[model samples]
Target: MRMCSADLNLLEKWTWNSRQNATYAGDLTSDGYMSTQQLAQAWKQKFPGLLTDNRHDYLFKFVNDQRSSTTFRAFTEGLFRAQEDTYDIAKETDEKLLRPYKFCSSWVKNVEENNDTLTQLRTFESKQEYKEMITNISLRLGFNYDIQKELVKHMYQMCRYNKAWDVSQISPWCAVFTKEDLKRLEYAEDLETYYKYGYGTPMNQQIGCTGVKDMMDFFKIHVDKDTPQQPRSSVRLATAPALLLALGALGARRDSAPLTADNYHSAVALARRWTSSTIAPFNANLAAVLYKCTPNSNLQINEQYQVLFMENEKPMNLEECRVGLCNYTFVKNRFGLIADNCNLDFCNSATKTTGLIGFTLLFVFITKLL
Candidate 1:
């Protein structure tokens, strides 16, 4: 019943408009506004059992909900307005909480800006399956010539966006591609995501430990039962890249081999385990819950356990504990090193250069010094 979201304003506007425009049959008065009792009855009819029979309860809930929305809007607007008054790009970039990856020079250089990271992505686009998809879609749409990859990608995105916005209506852009073709396009995107931001690179996992460490520290305090000044639960809104890094830190949904063009057809079976559609989809969430278990006849004292859920399903199992519920001690020991230190030196150190060029540079530097 408690709602906090970035779309609060939109939701409020939609709710207000819907309520104002809705026909309430006999509930409306001559003045075109319903009494408290009439409004309650109308809400009860519309939502069925969600609203109580008492008009006072309805009014109280409405007022509190509106207050929450207003407070949230004011807080967010105030923060942004303050930022606008004294905007400094450098200062903003230096904020670790806001831009954690920007602090890691090596990650910024080797991963974020590296052209080599897109090797698999470029290869996938050049593959026969991808080219054929473009050709087939063009022919299906009555176009004389084959459409470019960018055009197809744009159409695919439009189809996805339109479908998400209104599920009741089918998008015209989606008509260009068949179900099979959509799957291929989805797979192509999966390759890009996996390589660019996922467990394909070790640096991602290393950087991800920073977030995991904070989560572990918070959970540890709860397990120990020491009263804290902070809120019981924590929520962080992060970008897709940050989400991917956190997934890497947790070591979840990783395949034995890297996703590449060679395994495009073969990796279809592995899609269930490693596909981006499931791993990093829109509004994706990863959560860990701590549960206190009562002492049974086998034990004398109460115990605390933890369960990690990805999108509401417990998908990971730790070797030290049971399938779904992991022992606190085991969870602590397993990720202790990662949680303690993310080995930030790895981010500071330059990646090793290779081949004749590297040796030539070293030789030239030594020769010049002598």
Candidate 2:
């Protein structure tokens, strides 16, 4: 029953952590060798959010809708109990206990062999990731019926972009004119379009406006000459979501062609009026923006997003296409500071130009009018 200190330590470690599945059944929910009962008691006292919130994720993470609604409702009712607690539980061991659940090869192999619906799902970059995700979901409850059709519609719309954009989905000259994406779009729509874009937004001040100086003011790095290892001043970090919003707007694209690698640089060069990185910045912003979800993954991942989609001019306009590809509405909501009737997307009014000498400078201008 007794052992050396090192042996005791390893035993305690394994007892506390399964070093695998993050589920409650694993050990390592605590410091070491803490029993499941002790871990559960600790969780009850410390992390209440971990209890109720994980109910959805635990069942949904790799689960599809297999159980009936009645079953789900009952599952939730019993599964979502929070015991009265005086403190939060720091189940540090729980993190290590659940790592094994991350990869279930058997689950994937089964989907590949037994699931025929997996074939109907679309692929991106010839990889099996998206289809694998769908198969995993189908394995859960409630996905037994017409889920295939739903996924088909979703894949064709969000994951394929080798052809010209549907004009109704974008603005004039906004589509990048990709041959592969539009061909796929055509097959899906029976050579028909959902909408149309006859007249495009006025070309004046669409993207390049005067706020370039203010936007750049925020990018400067402060340093200490004495130590190259660390900066004396704080590096105020900003999010890239705002940049996505401006690019997502109906303004930046032209009716002439899809925003491809050929034209994105031109668009960025035009946008240099308000930012620092030039064409490089434009490409970086597109990469950041594309990572977010869009309604139209069917378009293409590598398809240049610099062009906003429009209606009638293509299958989906660039402006509309932007919304389809990413969820940037929250960032756009922050652009309210732009003057009403301002010709451009936004002015970055939260800007302040601070000089090393001291006084902070503020500036505002009509994007198009000036």
Candidate 3:
């Protein structure tokens, strides 16, 4: 059976209210999908000052991209519009540079689509701790027997979303879970993510090298003496999975050993580096800033330095350089394994064509026999 982190029913119920609050009453369609116009209006409501100068009619035209059905594109475009900048569709389309995981068929087949990916997650659900948590939640709700896993899961998701959307007011659903119980549930989620997206699988990190390479290439261009001094920025938006992959590639907050169901009890002590809430939470970000240092007697001319930040905070120091600033050359040398050969690394060309060739040979043999 396919497992989902959140219940669809709870999502529909919660999302409807959130979307309604953002837009007009009855703005959503029967299927709960919003039109481009309604989406733009919702964006305007969320950031009232963002589009003050732009005309309302022009806003609709800007966000209405028929090629993509999802509102994600519209939201991204809205951000660029707010900043008076153009969204680079071409750069975003460079899948090899920005999203190498898309080319990794092995990762898709072996990890993502594979049932074994959730082995630890399934194991955790069957564990005594997990069962007791469910029972306790059911008892809290005044139920005689244990509540269905699906219902409890939905409750947890509702609790999480309600708190995330509005932090001041606690959700009624959250009352069922105590502080300890919430921690357990959160660990369960961490297990799933660690295996599916984080360092449990090596390919996840391998594919993430594309983003690392892109960053290095950008830094190299600016750090070069021949390169002109100008204000430059590289902004790449990606999902949580991609973010986790990139983090794994950078060896950021990596545990000494992989997190598994067997070690669930010792997670706090053993897996200190593998916390999903801190590493890849809602709207999580990882950034690398390059600074040109002033030439002192000890420092070379045009000396460039780099610093890494996660969620707007400097979490750790680079071993190769000083506590805050890492030399550019050292940083690039460390990530030298990340080459511009995503297709070679990710795309399993031989494996992909083997089945087709075998089938064609079989067909030819049968034709000769006939």
lDDT for each residue of candidate 2 in 1-370, tens digit (9 for 90 to 100):
1234553353344322243344432211122222222433342343243233332222111111221122222223333444333122211112111111112233223221324312222222123433443343344323553245355444444322111122223221112113443333332231111011101112212221112222222112211121111111111111122222233232333334322212223544233222222211211222111122223456543332122221111223233344433232322332222322333222222132111011111111000000
Lowest summed lDDT over 10 consecutive residues: which window, candidate 1?
A: 361-370
Candidate order by TM-score, decreasing, is 3, 1, 2
lDDT of 3: 0.54
Q: With candidate 3 superimposed using the best TM-score fit, by how many Å does residue 304's alpha carbon deviate from the native?
A: 4.4
Q: What is the C-alpha lDDT profile of model 1 across 95-204, one tens digit per residue? A: 34323566777887887778887788888889888888888887766577888889998888767655554566566676667788887887777777676668767777
Candidate 2 weakest lDDT stretch, 10 residues: 361-370
Model 1, TM vs. native:
0.64
Alpha carbon lDDT of residue 56, candidate 2? 21
Clashing pairs in 1: none
* Candidate 3 TM-score, true structure as reference: 0.68
lDDT per prediction? 0.52, 0.25, 0.54
* Candidate 2 TM-score over all chains jointly: 0.18
RMSD of each: 17.4, 24.8, 13.3
Candidate 1 error regions (>4 Å):
1-95, 226-230, 267-269, 295-303, 312-323, 345-370
